[model samples]
Target: MSDWLHNLPVPMMALVIFGFTYFLAALVFVAVALAATEERAKSLKAISPGMLPVLGIIFGLFVAFTAAQVWGDSDRAGAAVSREASALRSAVLLAAGLPAEQETKLRGLVRDYVGQAVAEEWPMMAHQEASLKATPPALADALKLVVTMMPQGRAQETSQREIVAALEQALDARRQRIIVSLASVNSVKWWCLYLQALCELLVIGFVHCDNRLGSAIAMGLFATGVATSVLLIAAHDRPFTGQISISPEPLRQIMPEAPTGHS
Candidate 1:
């Protein structure tokens, strides 16, 4: 069920979340209607006049802040991906300065690394897992192979050094990408959101029982609005999954031979 939910497109997920939230709110309304006495409802309604606006404002701000944080994290994850791809391109260009024989070897190594990255590493990003084939030792082996040959000239030597540095930079960026991919909003925060939403809905259900149609309409809208925020956060939460995932296009273009991978 979770996988099915996660696989849904952003809009679909938003709709699903909205429907579920509204249904839950409806249940709350029914429960309150069953449980409330006239006297209790009147008292709660009296307090509701003073409380609803304040609670709405606080919860709205909290949800907005949480959404902002997730969006920021997703943005950083995308930037890290671009930076990693750029460094890879730099390493490729630097390889051009080597002798023909050495250049072939270095380029092949780079190609394999890139191939494995797109082929094996990229798919793992959706789940925030590192690809074993694209691990440091595997990439380092490819790099070590490039530096093993003596440089043909001063220019070649300089280029080799640059290639090494660029590869290192790429690795650093890759690490950052991995870290960002793995990061997510805390579960505790999500639980708190649910708790707050439930409380607010319960209050609304109790205070508005006299006008079922009006309360249902308002409850549906409010629940959908809050769920939309949550859905937006969920969509961006991974930055490497769902409809808004970071594309592997940059890596594909940079990779020589351009191996088709599971995107």
Candidate 2:
């Protein structure tokens, strides 16, 4: 229920969040107004000094902090995807420097790896699941296969070394990306965000106990703003699941197609 709210399109998210929060705020206001009437016989104060402004400041800072953290996580996830693709491209270039037999074999492995990652593994990540179990990169086997072909001379040996290094880097990048796909913000932080939002509304409830309709309007506006920010943060909570997600464009660009015979 909450996730659906978070990932909704911006206008829908704002409307839904405002609707729910406004209802709750109105309910709180009614209760507070009754209490204020009862207490007025003894004391005529609506609320304590400076509570609303203080709570507003606190809410704003919390939103800013959470947004920054989630933004950083999303950026890191995207960079991991790019790095993995770059390493794979490097491996392909170095593989070309090998003998014809080794070159074909290595290129085939690279091609299969790219194709699988783009078509199969990427969809799983979008769903916040681990990558597909079938057709695992078999990266180790590929490395060992290349190592089996002893280089003909110093130049070949150097090229093989660079290819091995690049593949290893690609493997590391893929590992990072998989870990990132499974990542999420902590539950405690979410609790704090919601708690503060409620607190801000509660402050409004108490301060506006004398005017229900005016309070409701104020809360509607406030709720619209807060809920939009909260949903924006929530939309970014899962780096791979929302509007601002990492794409597999890099991998797709390198996917091997059939050989052409134009000549």
Candidate 3:
């Protein structure tokens, strides 16, 4: 089912699903309204046709809000990844301040970590799991050595403090990247999409009752609108999947020689 849904030309699929569902809903609503009118013919029933316009306005607003949220989420994910890559690069450069051997080891660790994320974590992001692990023990060990090398004077204390600060920043960046990547899936957005879909169906149904030709046109319009919205939301929601997904280009550029392993 998932594959089938994913395989459809997104725009067309969205239209077909929304149009059929809404048309059915309109039929049911018209039937009920007609039944009620028949039951109270002597009471002079007056239907408020204005409600349709109001519904359309509400639907438009809801769709706009969802689109904004999806776009925001996509932007945030991209920014977070970029920030992480920058932090990693900065950390690698700072490692040069350490003793020669320690610097080489730290740089290697950073390269390995970036490589693992690109090769492993990236591919599995769509699946919501990261299997490859590039341990930070090597980096930690280098930091420990740097701290020990500090002399008993004020300069040593100051240098040690700087090293600690850089390490902390790198670790924080790494944590942020992981958290943001994991949170790429916005379930609440999905629910909102579902509600918007329901409302769209209701609107289509209302049109169906007023005029058959008009209803068909409305269905076409509604289908196209809803499908476009869903496609936009899905593209952003799974920012790591599909052709429009965010690329790990920054990581690639940073660790050119790093091993490509799962995570």
Work out the TM-score per prediction.
0.89, 0.86, 0.70
lDDT by candidate, in order shown: 0.76, 0.76, 0.59
Query: Cα deviation in Å at residue 181, candidate 2?
Result: 1.1
Model 3 Cα lDDT, one tens digit per residue, 88-158? 66666665565666556666776766666677767666454542255356446646766767445665465
Candidate 1: regions farther than 4 A off: 1-3, 131-138, 258-263
Preferred candidate (lDDT higher): 1 or 3: 1
Residue lDDT tens for model 2, 88-117? 888888887799877877877888888777
Clashing pairs in 3: 26-205, 120-262, 120-263, 132-262
Candidate 1 has which clashing residue pairs, if any? none
RMSD in Å for all candidates? 4.1, 2.9, 5.9
TM-score, model 1 to reference: 0.89
lDDT of 1 by residue, 1-263 (tens): 24456668977988898887887887888887777677777765665445677778878887887888888878888888788789888877877787776666666677777777677676777766764344665468757866686877899889988988888888888888777777777778777787788878877776787778877877787787778878877777777777888887887788755334786
Query: What's model 1's lDDT at 259?
Result: 34
Q: TM-score of predicted model 3?
A: 0.70
